[model samples]
Target: MSQETLSIAGFNVSPHHYIGGQRVASGELFDLHCPIDQSLLGRISEGTPAHVDAAILAAQAAYPAWSALTAAERKPYLDRFAAEIGKRADAFCQLESNDAGILLSRMKHGVIPRAMLNITWFAEHALSLQDRPLETEQATHIVRHDPAGVVVIITPWNSPLMLATWKLGPALAAGNTVIIKPPEWAPLTSSLLADCAHAAGLPAGVLNIVQGSGAGTGARLVSDPRLARISFTGSVPTAKWIAQAAGANLVPCSLELGGKSPFIVLEDADIDNAAATGALMYRNAGQVCLAGTRFLVHSDIRDHFVAAMRAYVEKLNIGDPRDIAVEIGPIIHPRQVERVKGFVERALADGAELLWGGKPHPFGAQYFEPTMLTNLRQDSEIVQNEVFGPVLTLQTFDSDAQAIAMANGTDYGLGGVCYGETAHATAIAEQVRTGFIWVNSFGIRDLAAPFGGIKRSGIGREGGDWSFEFFCDVKDVVLPKKPFRASFSHR
Candidate 1:
């Protein structure tokens, strides 16, 4: 998001399916639980297959006009939409905090601004994107970027507003109408986002959000044959299902599935600096896909690094997410808390050391402690899989090669971090299989740089022109410089 500190106020929430720029309520509904206190946030109308159909039709109807507009022509709508969201940044922050148990400060500082940034950035980038032209004696060939038809964006709950816009910005900038399916747990933001678009005077059916269970609503949306693109940020199984569904229609897809990314620390690394960065496993309560949950430290400094991490994590204020001063908050869901606890329990049974914080905090079952584990076997289930919590596992490596090997061993190759002298750390980072890495820092975002993953972590790159590339189709058009003779006569 944005690095600068900004003031937050408040915003309104809507309850309905945003179709054709109108609120359509449903008889059937689902419950939204607040993870901070395990309270029922509210009951949201469930989006059925019918709702999905309506949204798809709405998007299809809007597509002709939206896609007909040039990227430059489309920029005004994006700009106004961003302006609407910016005005409600404060209220958006509080609602997200209440809805998803994220620290309010984090939502303000690291997440909310991203919605505005994503839309504005992609709109500008689309304007800057140049078409490829090749000239020959006979003709000139140009590769033109055209909008894909209607798009379906399935966003994850961990960072709903930011992640949804991550795909939404490019999809809209490329002049495609979009339908978003927000995770049932944190569905409010998407509805509110839809309201923002409507308030910004966006045309009816240009941006739609359908909310409900993945099986009923999401399954129906992806299975539709009219989709031109499907961009998903979620689990592997769901992405696999999307791939299959899209496969049937020959529809293109981009999946940003979560990662079990690794963070490698060399013997020469700065202990305090490395520890502080590693402690960020607790950021966003460690629900982030790019979190470095696995720590591969040098054997000589493993103990010291773990000690420093424990000190850093312990100081974090863990409680109600609405509290501006709290550094850590609850896990997004109750089952996720139990799942995180289970991973640590299994590791403990397998002889892993519990360096610190293994169970639910005194706050309740919904809040997990900032957990740390060491003495883990590299082949163990906990070591090899994703915990998706405030859990950190420490594994010592005897050499840089071994650290890189251990880091690359996971099926995930999303984001990795290496810490040491610049050249040495960068040398090791060069061999790491992940799509992106930082030598001594963490979460330094560059929207112009390529971001995504290799292996099972994800399928494509995004940001800058890459986003335009995915959301737009390239068609070669050739024009003869002079009148052409008949081919048969030339033969």
Candidate 2:
């Protein structure tokens, strides 16, 4: 491939499946295009069930040596890997921004740096894993943590590297050999990750990358009995299928699915701050799982909140992602743009008032304007479903109780935000059903805290000690109080 046709992080790129520390080619190929201009990015191998089997067999073969190493022995490799990523951070960010249609500014300043921090944080945290001892009068019990044999991590295209590292950092630190299946839409950076692993001197088969569509490669990997566990981040419908397949094999799986999270603005909230944070609905074109897509403002200040939010979104620059000044960029693909437009069109037909920017941008093929809608019914499809685009739905709540009820009404319980006075926000946050809540702010994440959701959003946590535990199994050893004596005379 020529540099103009297939370039990633300033390097001419050709995609291949990474297995047993070697880049392997397949008979079939799939083209990946840049969403910004629909330009040809590169071609990736279309992995088959046979490829999945090979990746699994490679991971299984590497498990013994990889797992036998103590955390102290493993930390150096992880540290080196983090350093390698740091060296190429700028290039990686640009590649990701172009490949995923995220703004270059956000990718360079926010996502890429955070991904590096994730690797470093988990590398050091691995050393803190210590056995626990429970002492009792009759017996003493000792608990040990052991790595699962082979783990499969499947990540979505929205935030491919960040989400993949969220699982990979801890999974590798816990000493499990892994197979990473990046979504077909954005798999470029993941291939770069495999390169970094090799440069860090990781053993063969310790980390593998398999590139293919979800239905073909994803299903095969999930159903494989050799897989010790699976960590997946994607749509709820796909998560359900993965859960069923993993369940049949009696393997544990961690799912981080979709969200239609609520952003509640109280009557006494600081209008400026609330509006600023609420504008996060347009961040990454609102494709984030934690994006607060539903707005439930107190009726007394609903008008003020709507006006402020509109002003904030109107000032946002929407154009080519490569432009550093652009705040909102293209959707991941043309199909996704159509899906977002469908949601807006249905809301208009259902009698919701469109405040601003509800149609496709005339400047680009895959661009949807930042959209705002008000007076939407609480049970309406647009209000209840995840648009996964730069779209926001506005509604009003009569009281604090009503706000809490509306916040917890959705099937999702991933993330939420409450804006008001400190004590008032705290009270409302306590009643919210989501796994994580932000008070007076949004998108502030601490790597040390556990992150996951209840209800249908997800099943298992994915940060701090929770991530370490997810890739490991616990074993208990009990000791008798005293030595036993021979009792042959009793017979």
Clashes of 2: 0
Listed in order, each prediction's TM-score against the native is: 0.95, 0.96
TM-score of 1: 0.95
Show the lowest summed lDDT stretch of 10 residues, model 2. Answer: 1-10
Measured by lDDT, the strongest candidate is 2
- Cα lDDT tens digits, model 2, 427-487, are 9999999999999988888889989998989999988888978998877888878886768
Give a tens-digit lDDT track for model 1, residues 220-339: 999999999999988888999999999999999998887878888899999999998887778888999988888898989877887888889878888888888988888998788878
Worst 10 residues of 1 by lDDT: 1-10
| lDDT, residue 329, candidate 1 | 88
Each candidate: how many clashes? 3, 0
Report per-prediction Cα RMSD to one decimal.
4.3, 2.5
